[model samples]
Target: GDSVTQTEGLVTLTEGLPVMLNCTYQTIYSNPFLFWYVHYLNESPRLLLKSSTDNKRTEHQGFHATLHKSSSSFHLQKSSAQLSDSALYYCALSDRTGNTRKLIFGLGTTLQVQP
Candidate 1:
């Protein structure tokens, strides 16, 4: 079965620093859309970045991630990560051109920024 895996379900942080969350996936499909969704306190998860083009990275807001079919990975990263970055980050996927199923997700990483 195709599935997404994210390393470290939680990450602790300082007021101003960098945060990197590992995201890997396994699927037989060659073309799958990878996405990063950010869920703030009370708000629903919102799209951060998404892409199906291999090696071509996708970025949104201040976050960036890329899809690597060869590595079967799409790790999210940011420079000088902020306190406001404290929230939930979910790595997701939507399969091939013919598949219309809803997206699937990794458990998510809860970023705790300490002021």
Candidate 2:
């Protein structure tokens, strides 16, 4: 079975500060795709970053994440946290079984950026 973990349930940060959302995963498959999805208020969840290749960093929408096979981690990071960045962040894992693929999501972390 594959699983993802987001250690923090809520993270509060000041605007202009660095942001880092811890994400780690465990999967029986050798190669797993990790993703970060952001869900803003009243909006559907959207993909922020995704990576299947280990040790490669992926970035989108001012956020970035790197998939590390050795540590089984895909932490999302941003150099600066903005008010607009406040949202619910989800860490997900995708693995294939036979011809079907399944996505597993973590408990999710809420980012609250203060002005």
Highest-scoring model, TM-score: 2
Tell me each candidate's TM-score. Answer: 0.90, 0.93
Q: What overall lDDT, based on C-alpha atoms, would model 2 receive against the true structure?
A: 0.89
> Which candidate has the highest lDDT of all?
2
Q: Which residue pairs show collisions in model 2?
A: none
- Regions of candidate 2 where Cα sits further than 4 Å from its true position: 96-99
What are the RMSDs of all candidates, in order? 1.5, 1.4
Which portions of model 1 show Cα errors greater than 4 Å?
A: 99-101
- Write one digit per residue (lDDT tens) for candidate 1, span 33-75: 8888889988989988887489997777778888888888999
Per-residue C-alpha lDDT of model 2 across residues 1-115, encoded as one tens digit per residue: 6788896788999999999999999898877888899999899999888885778778887889899998999999999999999999999988754566578999999999999
